[model samples]
Target chain A: MAGSDCLAANDWICGEYVRSRSQELTDATLQHLWITGASVAIGLLLAFPLALVARRWRPAAGPVLGFTTVLYTVPSLAMYSLLLPVFGVSAAVVVTGLVLYSLTILVRNILAGLEAVPEDAREAARGMGYGPLRLLFGVELPLALPAVMAGLRIATVSAVSLTTVGAIVGYGGLGNLIYEGMNSLFKAQVLTASAICVVLAIAADLLLLGVQRLLTPWTRGRTNARAARRIRIRARKAAV
Target chain B: MGAVSGAWTWLATGAHWAGGDGVWHRLGEHLYLTVVCLAISCAIALPLGLLLGHLGRGGALAINISNAGRAVPTFAVLVLLVLSPLGRYGQWPTIIALVLFAIPPLLTNAYVGMREVDRDVVESARGMGMTGGQLLARVELPLAFPLIMTGVRTAAVQVVATATLAALPGGGGLGRLITAGFNRYDTAQVVAGALLVAVLALLVEGAFVALSRLTDPLRHRRRARRQSVNSRGLPKRWVTE
Candidate 1:
């Protein structure tokens, strides 16, 4: 119960640990963020082309989707281990695994988004003399923003969670702290590190949500109109 | 390739598959943990999802809570639980963490599936004087079966993957093989352990897919419709996380 003895007592929530190890915590958190960001970015890059290929060739869609789904089914530990031989004991192992795991969600969403573009919209773009590349970039992708962003958010959060598994290779960021803390039974370090991971995931999700809202103004407009119509209908019923 | 061959040799060793710390024992532990955690998650999540979904209320709250739950890493939860008083209770900490990890997909998918049941169908069933229970069991549940099964598949696979973490905390599972391998710097052992976990996860996923297809109440009708629609290739929505 001594104020300064929280560390000695191995309390679950010791401020002393955080105060003393602020630099270590910060470094871990930054690494976590960096890994999550890099993986999601690379996933998007790879998924975009694959999604495009799947969209362009009906015959290829089944295999592309099937392969990614299979990749996703591999356990994270196994994923890293499988890549370990190639990437060795480095951050690349974690990043490669995460990128592979992310493909299932990213590719599905991207393809879904592209497919959802109203046929008439594409027709109009075509009529306007837009080339295939121009049509995809100018009209189809913009319309597909919401679904793509949704995928990004999910993939980002998943990456954050999966990144901790990278701790097995000493590249798990905060996961390393949690792993070490758990092994030594260091209550404060485990709790604090875990809490930070939860926070990072939530913050990343919120940031992506904000980005989605900003990028897809038309989606917001449609929702607003739907809400306004509901309100108006309720008011008419009240009068009756 | 050498590493893979090494792993293959490790797996092929008859000695490694016997005794206390052998592959069979670890696999049993892994399956036990996966099954127990999944059963607990389904029991807790499915009924709540069904009730809320049937009422057409509070589903958003349930789904949001589960979604938020997804943000918390399973490893962190496992470590924290094991470090707490629950640690003294043996596998309780691991079970608790895994059950928590498995619930979100089950809950969300169930709720969404039930809610997605056609409103007109529900109204028609109500008009036919089917009681609430009858309607839920006969109509709504059948319609929602695929989504619910999808959730189960998702949760099952996730639980299998995560149960590996239990071995890190001195609990029992195939994860122990990986952690032990790491300690000894035996790359082949780690690879072998990883291969086992991956195979188990894939097998669980495949089992659920087969089970869902076989047991689907509307399988005949669905197959007929699918055949007619086969010219268009797979549906865009076929892939889900």
Candidate 2:
């Protein structure tokens, strides 16, 4: 009787338990936005200046970026630990680490984008005697903006996922709730965190998609085709 | 270099890295966990990637799903699954998360590789009365192998690096040393852990470069010739003979 009761209890524990909870998820979503937003802003501030300097003196990029890649591969928590001694376990340390993480992705892509602009286009601008700064800002930078934006999209998404690690240092986000739920063995809290994070990710991605569309009108054609195909596939599945 | 020097010095010192609570042992465990998770993820990803590539359908869906996978935080998934009925903690959950992390690159690559194969070659193969399976196996796969290999290589590096995230749930990887260092306020331990992760990523990248070369011999031969010409003014064999 005892063994059977234990088995029954285990079975009950294994089943799905979905319930209503809106406020907690909303609060988490907002926190995620702020954390990731601040981190990306910090990253762009650091990386753009470095990229401009590297473009002026080409060899500098190799070593500067090599160092950044090493920093990039360091685990998020590990970077935080290395920072904690001097910086302490505050929002500053978390932001610093997150910002550094974005550098490797953004800087390299920025450099690549600048280099990828056709030589002819640059020569034509030079023929007009627009000067170095004008040529770079007017010709190269605008062309490179799409690639830079793509890199920013990737960095933003990466920041979203990684900012969760900040919760370990008492920086609250969706991840904090998830961690708390796990430690306390609260299944409801865990589910809420997981669902909130997923929803937030989707919302952020869609927002970025909208931004991409607004910036690059040509992207709309491709996106519309893909969306139509997806609708068709989903409708077919539903009908079946 | 100014920023890195302090961390590097702490890791180099013997007292900090060695002991009963040794940073080195933990580093080894961390690397071991990362390597195992990457291997498992690659094994799963490579086949599914190839299958999706072969079908030539669902490329957008695969990539979107992968982007979704990347966006969904690893720790969040770990908590939800590990705390639920799955309650299956440790390396398995870590591996699952790592696999989820790595799948996007592999799938995207395979799809691109297959799609990029010369249309004329495929048409000729079909016109020769070759069956679809035979055409794919004999012509398409070999031609697509180089591009597919590029994806696999990328996935390998990414998986190894991301595997550190596994340390959170007591999955026992290098990140554990980092966490321990944080708790103890020991910069040395943290530095050693961070260095090991960086070294591991570079090592994996180097190995994959060699693997890609071995798998695609023509590219390797061309690279060798280019290097020889750049270094010695001419091919040594041609010069000597």
Candidate 3:
């Protein structure tokens, strides 16, 4: 069986698996970046404006959000199928689906962040002679940045994972490597693809975490201090 | 399968399915595949999660393991597993891969839910002459139920969506229609598949939302006004009501 063979053939790449396809890996990574990068950019562009409009008019928020949630549930493969006739099996369909998938998280979070702006802050802003646009840009947006960032983080991770599925439609990505590896029973290739994916996922997660901490300075310090205080209190109680 | 057959029959001769035979047959298989995979996943994950949660040891490691599980692509895993002596393909490999896919969310939520309950509540229960078992059964379990339900809802939607991959390996389902639509460049069949999946997701989400309300009495009163209006065919009034 290939499972046992994969384990026994410690020198997997050296044996029949010595397929020097490094170019394929590089091409796949580039395709993945473009696909994900474009999707997130498009999602943010649409979601931010809609989120702003929805916040100013409370009635619009719920329906817009509900529509996006349904869009989120629409499967990637199905989305491709739906778009195939008009767009054909190109990168356009893949990116469009990814963008649609990003909306639910981005919109929901943006709305949540805006709403979380304490009413008193807005009142204070108005008292200070700030206009609606200025109040949102200066006060509400900054306060909501953490939540918005959190949503973006979730969207980014989701996009990365979903991009793998896009490879099935002849769009090259790390997933193509995995698919090829599996088909040929090439352990090294499969492992290589999976490792790159894991590293990418972790690197993205840690990068987002760092960005979140940096942007939400007050939140980071307070949370870390609170955690430290809890640990200290528990340690003292245990010692007593 | 029903969707595919409908698309196929429509392609052959744009005709209505007679006696609903094709629809029921296709729906039955799709539902069967979904149910079996979910059941298998729950069987493995539920108790494992509960045990790990109650112990509160290895929390980070368990979560990280599940996170890695989440990171692995389900379809890729299927392809890999299928290549082995598990050389068997189709629904079985799909089921196995989906089960693995579902475990992380289920375990993570279950663990976090029970672990994050108010320590003071546990202490109070203990002081009131309750054993750990009693405390868990009456307090911890009830409190964690909502969070666990969220995980279940997430897993259910994910399973239904991913189970379509079974069609890739020769098993039949609505995904077959979608995949076939892609291969043959048939737009309507693809639309049919996408629409069905979207509808299925909404229905499941609605069902779970109702179930969550029924299980939690506190939410019942707050959600009742909305549910009653919905049942009365007045979705417009439901949110405001």
> Among these predicted structures, which one has the highest TM-score?
1
**Clash count per candidate:** 0, 2, 1
- Residue B185 CA displacement from its true place in model 2, Å: 4.5
**lDDT score of model 1?**
0.89
Which pairs in model 3 have colliding backbones? B1-B173
Off by over 4 Å in 2: A1-31, A118-131, A218-240, B1-32, B121-143, B184-187, B221-241
When 1 and 2 are scored with TM-score, the better candidate is: 1
- List model 3 lDDT by residue over A184-228, tens digit each: 677677766766776776677679889888877889778899999
Off by over 4 Å in 3: A1-19, A118-130, A179-191, A235-240, B1-26, B61-70, B89-91, B116-118, B217-241
**Candidate 2 DockQ, CA atoms:** 0.43
Candidate 2 per-residue lDDT over residues A14-34, each given as its tens digit? 223222345666776678778
lDDT of 3 by residue, B1-241 (tens): 4545554555454342222323334456667877887788778877777768877876996577665765566656666566555656445676777788877778888888889776766676688788878877876777678777877877777787777665554456567766666667666666666666667767877787789768873354335545664443322322353
Tens digits of per-residue lDDT for model 2, B1-241: 4336766776677776676456677667756765676677667767676667777787887667657767878777766556655556446666676777777777777778887776766776688798978877876777678777877777776676556666666566667766676677666666667677767777877787788878773465456767665443332333454
lDDT agreement with native, every candidate = 0.89, 0.72, 0.72
| Cα distance off (Å), candidate 2, residue A137 | 3.3
lDDT of 2 at A70: 69
Worst 10 residues of 3 chain B by lDDT: B14-23
Output the lDDT of residue A139, model 1.
98
lDDT of 2 at A240: 100
